[model samples]
Target: MTHRTTTGTAAPESGAAVPAVSRTDLPGGIRVLTERVPGVRSVALGIWIAIGSRDENPDQAGAAHYLEHLLFKGTGRRTATGIAEEMDAVGGELNAFTAKEHTCYYAHVLDEDMPMALDVLADVVTNAELAHTDVELERGVVLEEIAMRDDDPEDLLGELFDETLFDEHPLGLPIVGSEESIRGMSRDTLFDFWRGEYTTPRMVVAAAGNLDHAHVADLAAKALTDAASRFPTGVPVGPRSGASGLLRPRRALALRSDDSEQSHLMLGVPGLNRHDPRRTVLSVLNSALGGGLSSRLFQEVRERRGLAYQVYSSHASYADAGTLSVYAGCAPERLGEVVGVVRDVLAGVAADGLTEAEVVRAKGSMRGGLVLGMEDTASRMNRLGRSELDHGRQRSVAESLERIDAVTPEQVSALAAELLDVPLTAAVVGPYDDESELPGALQDLA
Candidate 1:
């Protein structure tokens, strides 16, 4: 959903073992990788094309997304309805998504239906009619999606942060382009983008669970053999030159009209890029900050202060850059105190630093969580594919844990200091207008 393309970071290939999945180059330039995970009844296959919102020029806003919809409307061999019915008949779940640097269509199905899933997915990507009629109808649906995001307070605020952070870059554009751009989109424009972006060499076909090298390779050969099309080499993506935000103090309030029980407040700042070696250290630091019920923000804000029902911190690193955010929900009456407790914990970590015991607990939590999560086939498959996308190859679970273990308390403390040093950009979605009374409202931290 978000584009994380960054420059100078190590391509994911740096630390990864050659994946267990065998890789092959097909006729059209598509690359396929497959691995067999035994004893699972289901198979998961992904068609990952290297096109996302970040590739869009401002003029083309949601063209990639529009193309994604047309892919399923009708392929040469399958009608739109037929595509859906055939998959459901076999209890197969098919889905697709657009992100900053990739568009992925995936399926989870009984092993026997793997071939069927591939045929359907391949057709959707390569043969959609993109007829004027289908395009016109879907445009309305997409517009409604745009409206929904604006109404969703928390989501809208994050979008605001991204927009402000990457003002002139493609990263600032929403995945679902503006209404004006979507309305202007023509079938030909959709076709041109697809023809230029979708190709065998630029694609990744990854399948895991109840599948083998032969089956995956065969599927890849059939679906991707004809996908080759070439374009000029891309110029590298650049860093965002924009400042952190547009929310001026005593200006218009960034509240949303949600009649829900609690109000949500979110604060964030730039963090690190995906390939940064200290990512593991950042991870440990994030967990200690507000990752769980036992986390510092949770302990101070929710348990002790009894202001917020929830509070958590997260760090997201992209190829080009990263972000660290803290989000919380609380009653309107308690918002001020909730903000105070959160600030206290943040300031405490940034100033005094994480204790030896705290760092150990965070490390155990992060490393232990990784080992426990890879047990499921779907999780394992996605982990591999996303890691490949973000980092190049997948790190073995043991290797991931080793990195976590190597993160010293000093590293975490240092990262905590770095992340908190910025003047925080805060977005609160609730009933308040001009929340000048927020605790720790002054931007200073550490």
Candidate 2:
């Protein structure tokens, strides 16, 4: 998913003719959310499940991602080829991904073909066969993906960073399990994980773009009736909750030596969760620090020094824990200077926040990004689905904007002081034999 700053302007007063959003909890714990957007012929539908890599035990590592692959191979009614043919007939898109806290299987198609899309999605999510033959075939594909990740310097650095920061927590593990785990996994093991985790209570169905709430609800009802009957009755489970206090700063830097001209390193610290009110403040601060071309990190690291071609800062928030990280890929010999500038900038921010002018510009950038992101049906649908699954309710575009608007420079400064004051954890990948051989400043990282 693309990283977006979701803050916008105030909404129109009540009684205005605006897009309509509706929610319903059908029988058997399946909840549905739909938005009726005017003047578009397309529809975006998503089935979001509240199970991800973090939910797995050490033995079940990668089961969620594996299931994502196998489900598209074939369902009870549609063969893998048949599924592809059906999607092509309608000129539709069908894809899915697994994250740390959840997985989403989504499709985009013309509104007229909504019924077919819903039916196919229901069939795959609810009735996947998970056959032994399919399992063996996908195993090789997953191994190849792992190999590909290892071959990329930035990707490998990212994995090392997470592992080092999160330590022994499940959040520390890679979403795609190691080669040993993937190769040793059995068909029965995946089947069992699927049966327990893929319940209706753990799912949300969200739709947007030229859709009628009642009509889409009916279509969904008919499609999922059989699957609903199979599910046990209870209140739907909410999104991933609670913080992993285990995500403390690492004492020793994690180094992965690679034969590359440029060194990829991330300097990060633990941050707030999704429910934290400070998240809004964090967004504003992140935009000013490294969210765009004009950000502090980009301007100082690239424009002033001309040390590297790419430099940026990013923030990731899970249920309870989060991270603020700065990434820079520079020549192996220039790594020390790049790391020094970043450390100094971060220290300055922690000591004293951004200027009033910087804060105003950052807020405007965030607001523009939020408004523009809502212009497309796909982004709108994603916002609805993710909000409902992660937050248990949806905030109106206006509401979200108001929160961002309410943020003060004081709030941002305080948040920076609290989060950035902690010791930094670093991950580096480049042409170096070991930590001892790295630059002097980087070697003492703690």
Candidate 3:
């Protein structure tokens, strides 16, 4: 179950690996990405498993996240504490996280400790001793995680948006499962999931910092040589085709006093997905609208009117569904005005689109940003791995550059019209006593 290694053209043609654009394949399909930094003595290695919250079934909502915790508990040769001892002994730090679509385990270590780091990661992932006691202990940790998200209004808003957007689908479920579902998780359950999905070919062991590709692959092979299995042959599922909608726009406002500076408001609309052809144009469109400080929303709302300290608009594209979002922080009294200003900006942009100069600057910022960011090993690994997950084989940086460069003002305008026209679902947490205006605000979208 190994794949052919591919190196994107983002790296310098010479031996110097520009950040992580250089991709090299190793035996067993262990991929390599690198960022060659001058005077640096270490490299950051990431063994990214192409599995995450979205991969969970109806009964295994939190299995991916739960498995992430257990991977560090113990392996065939080292205890959880011992794993730490070894990394600490070598001045290396290790950690992992489970995201909506993938789970990543990473380590930053000096040049000499690469072998040991690889071993520790491999033992934990391949030979985890997922004991019942470890599973029970970690279950509490995950529950705390769930509680934390529930307490934050902004977080809850996103959760609601997803639930509403994908009403009857898994795409809308939270990354961490519900309390009851998390409690139902077991060791055998995670093991079964891991065995089925965590095949050698479906994963990438990316190393940057200070290391060689051949050596890393050799170590990875030893650690994961036995991990050969046929990838599940399920038919590809298509994107959501039903009428896109969100949760009931109810007045759910919760304000608790805790010496806070400003309230955070998370407003969202249905967004596009990764496979959409309009993605490149949307990137530039989002940039001009609310991507950074110099955007239209910031200029109109903050600079001109001084309504809020922060305001931005952006989109999150996925494999099936997406969400275009607006985030802001402001005084309780100014929330209404801020909401109005955001709506006006969206309406204006959708109708008139951005200026030629605005489009140029946005694309320039995006182009320069992409060129500059790919100068690291971890970044290269992430780009290649992520694009591969979405578009299959790694695409050249030149291809990405051309795509972003080809975005026209008309394209951006059309996307804004489509996305902004969707219903606006918002979640506000602050001193918002007057709930009568929310309906008007929601109707103001587009």
Question: Any runs in candidate 2 off by more than 4 Å, and if so which?
Answer: 1-19
Model 1, 1-446: lDDT tens digits are 11122212222434545345555545454556666676788888888876789888766789888787778888778888999999999999999889876788889899999999987888888777788889889999899888898777667766665665555567657888888999888877888888777765556677878877665777666664444433223222222233333322121223344555677877666777776778888888889888977888888887887887768888766567677778888887777777676667777888878999888888888877887886666676677567656655546665777688888988888888877765666666666444454434422221
Best by lDDT: 2
TM-score of 2: 0.95
| Alpha carbon RMSD to native, model 3 | 4.9
Instruction: Tell me which residue pairs clash in candidate 1.
Output: 3-100, 6-319, 6-320, 12-391, 12-392, 28-228, 29-200, 29-201, 30-200, 30-201
lDDT of each: 0.71, 0.85, 0.70
| Candidate 3 runs further than 4 Å off | 1-39, 229-263, 431-439, 443-446
Judging by lDDT, tell me the better candidate of 1 and 3: 1
C-alpha lDDT (0 to 100) for residue 204 of candidate 1 = 69
In terms of lDDT, model 2 sits at: 0.85
Ordering by lDDT: 2, 1, 3
Query: Comparing candidate 2 with candidate 3, which one achieves the higher TM-score?
Result: 2
lDDT of 1: 0.71
